[model samples]
Target: MKADGEALVFYENGERVGTVPLAPLSRVFMRGDVTVSSSLLGKLGERGIGVVVLSGRKAVPTMLLGRPHNDAARRVAQYRLSLDPDFCLRFSRAIVEAKLRAQAAFLGERRESEPRSRYLLTLSLKRLSSSITAVDQQATIASLRGVEGAGAAAYFEGFADLLPERLHFCGRNRRPPRDPVNAVLSLGYTLLHAETVLALYGSGPTPSSASIMRSTSHANRWPVTWSSHCGWRSTSMH
Candidate 1:
């Protein structure tokens, strides 16, 4: 958790209990009640080090989460997750199914049989689908270039506007920490994009891709928060 980058910490009941990787490890395993402060965790994550939070039994990793992500495979996986042509088709079918269920839910009341709700739902679904496709396209076309990194960013514009207003919405109320749908998509794909970016951060001879990665990560922890992908935070710059 220290900037030492040489330290691997584990805590027991808030007490710093031990360390590991006798050598400087590129990875760290935070197990049990091992206590490391969030600052250390953020530093580790910033360095692109992998952090694995374990479950109670130690055998089951209840949270196999990524810190700042360091994989390139996620790019390809995201394309699949981005909802291609098949996704559009399936989404449409889901709308129809939802509408039918909606009608059935109201059958006992013998109401006016309004299709407005269904129509709005379907329309919202289409718009949401379009937004998703746009984000996917952006991710697909993006390269390591400064300008290019954001070429695909536009596809996910105005993401803050889409979320279920009825639910608790993650303790945000009128102004939620983040919209559920947007939060899922942002956290999911950004992790993939960041991993790809991190792997290229300092692994090259020429400054081309690596320099761009450094600049991007420094300017903004895009992998962490795409909202400011161009941020120039000194901490994440490295």
Candidate 2:
């Protein structure tokens, strides 16, 4: 990749392949054997554009934030708030409840369209509804996580029913993702995770340094790794 006046030009085997305008673009995602010139990177940084590199067969993401915010206090507050146990519990509960509700709603919608699949979808929706109630009643973050996990299992079971017969997807699988459907799902999740991290950084918080429902030891170690590699403070919890 190289800067060509107002556009970023892409090359393959010494031949020009494409050009993307710098204006109206906030970020760029590069994957697999892509070479970016220092001049183009500098230009992108000057224009406040973030760049994310997704590498390897699994598409692991590494993000480059445009510039650090001037407000140090906001980041400090975010760090402190993340350490509060009560706050973490409440935040986790809310996130889980919202996610489960959305899953139930999606299943409900699919049930309307696929009446033959109604039995499985309805069962999943009921499980999600129960999980939402359990999330609200939970006192500890660990129990809340358990509820979320159960709800996710039920939700994915129904999701498999929605896939076309050609896909042959029976359940969710990851890490290596044996089937094409699972591979696509894994890629989609990786992209979403990258986007979420970017959004968190843009909203004045470090993603690798904060923990919401994650174990304390893991949260503490993640920030160190992120900071070491990315030259930015890490905050993470999920």
Q: State the lDDT of candidate 2 residue by residue for 139-177, as single tens digits.
A: 887787689789888988888888887887888788779
Q: Residue by residue across 1-238, what tens digits does model 1's lDDT show? A: 4434556665555566667652455555445565556777666655556554443531222222234334556544444533364543343333323332332233212223434334433443444444333432332122223223232222122111223456324322111125454344433333433433434333321112211233354323332222223232211211
Total clashing residue pairs per candidate? Answer: 8, 9
- Candidate 1 has a TM-score of 0.27
After TM-score superposition, what is the CA distance of residue 190 in candidate 1 from its true location, in Å? 3.4
The top-ranked prediction according to lDDT is 2
State the number of backbone clashes in model 2: 9
TM-score of each: 0.27, 0.87
* Each model's lDDT: 0.36, 0.73
Those runs of model 2 whose alpha carbons end farther than 4 Å from true positions after fitting are 216-238
Query: Where is model 1 poorest over a 10-residue stretch in terms of lDDT?
Result: 204-213
RMSD of each predicted structure = 14.6, 5.6
TM-score, predicted candidate 2 vs. hidden true structure:
0.87
